[model samples]
Target: MSKDFYTQFILPYAGIIIKICRAYTDSEEDFQDYYQEVCLQLWKSRENFKGDSKWSTWVYRISLNVSLSLLKKDKKVNKKSVELPNLDAGAPQDPNPFNDESLKLLYLAIKELSELDRAIILLYLEENSYQEIAEIMGLSPNNIGVKITRIKKKLKTLLDGKIY
Candidate 1:
């Protein structure tokens, strides 16, 4: 991919990277650091990107790979607890942004989900088509659709406090 292609096509999706990082990290700093790492890894892998896939699909592949690899490293280093250093010990928590408390709760519930579920949720939440999500995740489009359906129900239940 050319630099302009990266900037134009890939940069606008940076929020998705932030969401992925936040899903993987418990603390804000670690989230930022991991997001930066994902950006670097994505840039490094630019040449490996082929035109067979959408840019978003390519980014999803790269970001998920980096996040999962980092998660594995984290597991190896901190087997019991994944606590990050406390940088904002006294900072007040910010209110969730979505007007729909359910949506906000959904994002909170997403953080509790496994890494695989997080990727599914991230793409679905971004309004990616089932085919695009399937392409990025290497799942059949039908399977991706079903999983997304199940996950959405799971999110609603969690948001409604039907299940913790």
Candidate 2:
């Protein structure tokens, strides 16, 4: 990609990249680290981008791979005393009248979902269609729909009736 192309096409999607990183890491410092790592990966992979896929698709794939690796590192650091399920799973319910505090609670809830589910829910909420989501997730659109329904039910249970 040309420098101008990098500046225009790629940089604009930084927000999406950051959101994915934030969803994976709770702390600002951790978010920054992961965010940088994802960016670096994107730049490294940019030359390989054949324009066969959307730039967003290529970047999303790289970012997801980076996030999953970081997650594995986290697990190793913590050790498997009690298996830590996905954060979006086993997360507390959302408090009523959502505010900053409640929003944090919601993210905590989101973190409970599996990484793939997290990607689905995020892309869904961001208005990506099942077809697009399936593309990012390497699943069929039918499978994406089924997984999303299950994810919604799980999120509802976790967020229902919980105070922030």
Candidate 3:
């Protein structure tokens, strides 16, 4: 792929890509694989984009699809544990929400959700409007709202009702 495409398209959306990939993968190695695959898919599908949706929406759909696909593939193979470097190890201390213990617990709870539910909750946490989520997820706006409510309840239960 051209450096120009990487700089112009992927760079701006790196955060979205990272968050989607991280939410889907359990370990650093898997995370790296998923991220690279999503980028490759984005590059390959660029020519097929037909002005049907906002560019960010396209990114979200592609990222989610790639993550889900890779996750299923990984499950088919027997996985071995690999220790990874601390993700926050050389980073400056900031008030990032991921640094919060409660948020960590929330993420743990999220992992217990079904794959489709994980995508819905991830998009919801990103503050995507119900309609936008519906558009990206190929669901009705009302269905998105209902799913979000159920996912929240599931998270609350998974967290023992401590950090809803």
Candidate 4:
């Protein structure tokens, strides 16, 4: 992507991209790799964007797709579970926005979800309307509602220690 485009569009949406990368990755290194890959993919796919939806929505779609592809590739090669770092057991405090312990655990729980469920919950967390999520995910609006309910229940179970 051009510097102007990155500054004007992608940089503004970098927070969303980082959140998606963090949700899918298990380590700081992996997170950085995923974030870089997402940016590269977004730049490469810019021509495919038809303005059918909002720019942020398109960025979300690209970020999730790139993350999922990397995740699947890693699983096929390693077949080993990668533990995410416990931010609660950190070395020092800083001004990082994603440093809350509760939010860390929440993301850990989200990591346990199925790929599609993870995407759904992330979009929900972003405050996307059901219709908008449906459009981005290519699901019916009613289906998005039903899935969100189920995903919430699953997340609650995960948080409650009933399931992980």
Candidate 5:
């Protein structure tokens, strides 16, 4: 049953997991940890799924929540300084599908955002509608719209006015 669930549900949504993990982590090791934790939480909570939202939406919510939880725990455990990504370093040390400089810069900028803002932007970037994003984020559709606009402006300022 676990194997079937993994293949049928988790594998199909690995990209969503990866994106959320990358946004929440600073290093390859941390990224791997976040990814594993997200998958584990999803599997553990498999029976809790109620089909109230799409499978993809559930995956997004779980992935984001797991990443945020782990990030908070890590911060409390060790107050470490964040290292900015060296854009001129070419490809990242980790296996990242988003290796382009622009994408890397965008992610770096996103990392500077507040947790909720980061989640909102990530969901928006995934092309989730405001309504769907609200559903996953437990926000009202109107709130999601306003938050997305504000998040985008924050990101642009972070990117030195570059519209990502």
Candidate 6:
């Protein structure tokens, strides 16, 4: 990717990509791999973008799909311990709601969700409307609503330590 494109297009949206990656990855190494692969795939698939949706939405779809694919491959190859790194290492210390300790716990809880539910909750947290999430995930808006409700309950249970 050209510097101009990287600066103008990818960098502006890198945070969203990173958040999606972090949601799916257990370790910083895996997160870096997913982030790089997502950037490469974004460039490779740029031609397929037909202005049907906002560019960020397209990026979100690609990032989520790439992370889930890598995760599935990892699971098939290694059924033992996944060996996730310390979650705090290398994480930005910036004082944002998403970076706070409670939110970090929320992310750890999110990581326990099934891949599709992880993607859905990440999109919802990003403030995407249910219609937009449905469009991205190829599900009906009503289905997205129902899934969001269930996912929220799941997250609550996970955070409350009610679920093993």
After superposition on all C-alphas, the RMSD of every candidate to the true structure, in Å, is 5.1, 7.1, 3.0, 4.2, 4.1, 3.2
**Against the unseen true structure, what C-alpha lDDT does each candidate score?**
0.72, 0.73, 0.82, 0.82, 0.82, 0.82
Best-fitting candidate, measured by TM-score?
3
Kindly give the stretch of ten consecutive residues in candidate 4 with the minimal lDDT sum: 86-95
Candidate 3 vs. truth: CA RMSD? Answer: 3.0
Per-model clash counts, in order, read 0, 10, 0, 0, 0, 0
TM-score comparison, 2 vs 5, better candidate? 5
Ranking by TM-score: 3, 6, 5, 4, 2, 1
Q: Write the per-residue lDDT of candidate 2 for residues 17-136, one digit (tens) a residue.
A: 766776787665566667778777777776788987687877778878898798789778973232222223211222331346666666789888988888888778768788888888
- Measured on C-alpha atoms, candidate 4 has an lDDT of 0.82
- What lDDT does model 1 reach? 0.72
Question: Each prediction's TM-score against the native?
Answer: 0.77, 0.79, 0.88, 0.87, 0.87, 0.87
Kindly list the per-residue Cα lDDT of model 5 for residues 1-164, writing each as its tens digit.
37798889988888788778878888766777777888899988888999988999989989999998998999899845466433234222335556677887899898899999999899999899999999999999999999998998888788885644
Summarize candidate 6's per-residue lDDT along 54-81 as a digit string, tens digits: 9998999999889889888988998334
Clash list (residue pairs), candidate 3: none
Candidate 6: segments with Cα more than 4 A from true spot: 79-99, 161-164
Instruction: Report clash pairs, candidate 4.
Output: none
lDDT of 4 at 88: 48
* Residue pairs that clash (backbone atoms under 3 angstroms), model 6: none
lDDT tens readout by residue for model 1, 1-164: 46685577556876676566666777656666677777788788777887898776777787788888988897888843345424343222233333555554566688777788889988888889888888889899999989988888877767675334
- Across 15-84, the per-residue lDDT of candidate 4 in tens digits comes to 7887788788888667777878888888999889999889999999999899999999988898444776
* TM-score of candidate 4 relative to the true fold: 0.87
